[model samples]
Target: MSKPQVLMIGGGMIAADQILPSLYQLQRRGVLGGIGVCAQRGATVKALADVEMIRRAFPGHSFRPYPDPATAGDAPHPLLYKELIAALPPRQIVIAAIPDQLHHDVIMTALRNNQHVLAVKPLVLTRAHAREIEQEARARGLVVGVEYHKRFDDRSLLARRRYREGWFGEFKLGTASLMEKWYYRHSNFQNWCTSENSDAFSYIGCHYVDLVHFITGLLPASVSVYGIEDRYPNGNKGYLWTDARVIWNNGACLNVQNSLSFPDGAPGTNAQGLSMYCSGGDRGAWLEHSDQYRGLRYCYTQQPDAPGSTMFAEPSTDYFQYVDTGGPGLEVVGYGFRSIDHIIAAILRVESAREDQRSTILDEIDAAGVIATPSNSSYNEMVMEAGRLSILNGGREAVINAHEITLR
Candidate 1:
């Protein structure tokens, strides 16, 4: 059988760089059949583009443009939504990459009409919506999933292996950090470099949150946060922060701090890294600025040297040399160090659903959007709680319930 037909809801930054190319590859391999894409007319460069790009990539695939509600340009072309939705073949799986504010409407329409759905991260904007979507999909026996791809990374996979194998003793504390400056100055890049939005905590930091779960296999029961507001604000979509923190269920916690507001906006100099603490295993890695540490990047780990030693040293001769520099001055972004690779992998499926194991990670993705709380409704409440705490409560409190958490 050919790849199941796919319908992409948003055609912005993620679509252009990641999902589109990936799906086009799937199509070429005979794993995907017809493909359709809809991007509202007035979105920023990240999420908006002309059809020529898609046409050139998937020449034979069906591609179209619809008003994207998430973008400012969609206002004048509201009718395109239904037109795009209605034109799709019945039962085709829909991949919606829209944000929280708009997910409910778009996804519900598809579910009510009997289509499966694949959603991007932060599944729903609120707890209520989470419950609602979960119930709907299960009731309809349809697939619905959210993307959390950190679990797919090499480092993450090793962490999980050590945890499961008991290479680490009791697993006392785990800390994860996402720090860096990925901001764009108005004068440097063109009208815009890429991506219309880059909220440190919600958007970028979410990856670390997922990583916490991946390494420890422990889901956060709740989180209390502290965040910052950005100056440039990523093409004006708003909310780029300097730092954030999250405490999980096992009493082990995580601290996530990120800033697009770096004094220097280069990847190497802007620095971001993670450190984890466990009983038998303790590990950490960091980036040295291009000037001081040029090509001196490394990832070193250490175990207890003796039974009661309070200190640690390099366990063996194994360490990775970090190579995060390639540009002069401060514009090394032109190099191939874009985190966009991770984003692209999330949109792609390496194998057909049939070839994938049932009840595996990929299958879990389909179940991710389903909610255990809010009963038969969506998790709009939980999202409201997160949003409220983020904007109003000074990040001291976040609305999250472990029992109510829909997916692991």
Candidate 2:
């Protein structure tokens, strides 16, 4: 079978930084064939026309402005689901990396149009929308995956293996945190950060939430959260920090703190860590730290004060340092890229089986001793809505049951 084609939606940071780069790597390796990008408006789409990195990587590919610039130029124009779907091939894979609010509509539209979809994290704002999309995808017999890159992280994957083996003994406490530089909110990417549908919790906290679930296979029973909205002068007016307690069905709990207020001048650099304590021993087998390193000269500096800058070194971790720069191999095997690749491979595998009149993709792959699974969007959406309700109710416990949330 030929390599599957790709139609990437949204020309924002996710598309540019994550989707496009990953696709370029895959394209170089002959895993993915042709590629296209589309955005609602022309401004952002036009800005990507001359992107050197993308142009250098994908030499012959060109960006296509969907729904026409004249019509979708305004903010929040009429939903262009029909028009957008009409422009793609039936077997094409739609990568929806647009805003959080539009995820449900775009995903459902693509699935209903008989195209597989790979959506970004925090698939949708609410569980209802997520379930609606999942139902549509399942009804159409198509693949729908949510990109929760943490699941593909080497350390996190190790933890998952150990947890699945029942080596953790009994469920205990899980602690996770994610911190961004103080200037992140004030940067050019604040467009979606200020929106009501997206915030620090969904933006950064979703990683840990999904990580906890993916690592331990625990279903969230209840959640209680307290979050503070951004109040800086130019900061986006949304949840800048979130603290939450998630109770699993096994009576174990997890404490999560996500913040976007880490100053650049602070002693520690960006904060990203996870620690899970089991009942078996004093030492925890699960600990993933992406902060601080030794003998690293990389530092933070505003100006070159002397021959060598004396600015403090930012938190440095070689988490994604494995790359074969010289050849046509998996140049970048970071979890972020691996997450996207996994979904694409799954979709293509299913498509290939269907073309050969196979009974089922799962059965076919299983007979061949292949094990592949993508993170469930519905599950992530359910937990996110529960967290939202917990924050809305002033940290009151919110209950979750099989991808549905109820404020208790």
Candidate 3:
């Protein structure tokens, strides 16, 4: 069959850091055909050099600029969306890995065009928005697989397969945690940071939240979340976490926190882990995220009924010793890889698009809400209403707040 065509949206940090590299891989292998990119500015990602960077990895034609408005988020910029819409062939696969704020508008446009979308995780700002976008997607029979990559990793996949294969027997208990702080004081607060509802709750903790559902094949019948925004506008909680904790309805729990103003070495001195046990056997492992290191690591052990024996195991990999955190510090390098890997798999999954073209209730509602432009007024209203409901209910409503309702 012919390779899938791609339209890359956004040339921000992720484009520079991960998507550009992964696209290069797909193109070289012949799984991808031509690539057209959309960036508000004259970013390198949309240039001819980008074309050569992957499938056509060598000098080709000069980078062509779509007649897009020159300014991002500058609505008055002429031809911004119009030029982008006209620049590509219809039905090209779109990767909506842009900033969270732009998630609604970009994905909505692509879906309306009937192009399949690989939306990044928690890309929707609210559950109501997720519901609306999903409704439209379902009606269109278009695929909207989320970007939850840890679910796609070979190791995590093995764990799930073993659980299903009866290797671990029956599962009764499962637990996961990500504890480390990576907040910067100088972080930009208004545009991208203010709307963040994470002090680890959504940012750091949600990965494992979605992963548990993927690996154990169990949903959190319900979840109770608690978080505090200590660092605030000053950047106390950095990017992912300032402080947070969560407990799942299945009795599984997720605990995470950004290092408070604690003295040095507090975050590293601690360990983070995931453990699950059932009738015949049990297994658990620790996760180590490093910036200076070449890769990530996972170490786990399975034990028989006996207390002092080993059924099997995967040993840990060690490669760190803080290069000396100066003040209110964190390593940004190690944090974004998980997002990168997820993007790679999501693109591949949507590119194939040959599943039974079916869906479970859970899969269809995987999104919270889909926010789009004024044309998508219904969805925009959904987000606003959900937020209002959250505030008025004191976070007591499940129909609106999954994490908070259980607490109430």
The 10 consecutive residues of candidate 2 with the worst lDDT sum are 366-375
Error of 3 at 281 (Å): 8.5
Model 3 RMSD to the real structure?
11.7
Among all candidates shown, the one with the greatest TM-score: 2
Weakest 10 consecutive residues of candidate 3 by summed lDDT: 368-377
Question: How accurate locally, in lDDT, is each candidate?
Answer: 0.49, 0.68, 0.45
Candidate 2: tens digits of C-alpha lDDT, residues 1-408: 588777777777677656777887777778887777677666666666666655655556554555456556656433554577766778678888888877777887787778888888777878778667756765666777777666776777777778778787556787888887676666554666663655666678878877777777777788888878766456557777888888888898888888877776654445677777777565544444453333365555464342222366542333333354665333545666777788788777777775544336644433332122222434567677887787767778888876457787
In candidate 2, which residue pairs clash? Answer: none
TM-score of 2: 0.83
lDDT, candidate 3, 155-217, per-residue tens: 556676776666765445555565532322232332354424333344435556555555555
lDDT of 1 by residue, 201-308 (tens): 655566566655555556555555455543453344345553555655667666666545544422233444566666553643221111112243433255333222
Question: Deviation in angstroms for 173 in model 3?
Answer: 5.1
TM-score: the better of candidates 1 and 3: 1
Per-prediction backbone clash count: 30, 0, 13
Q: What is the lDDT of candidate 2?
A: 0.68
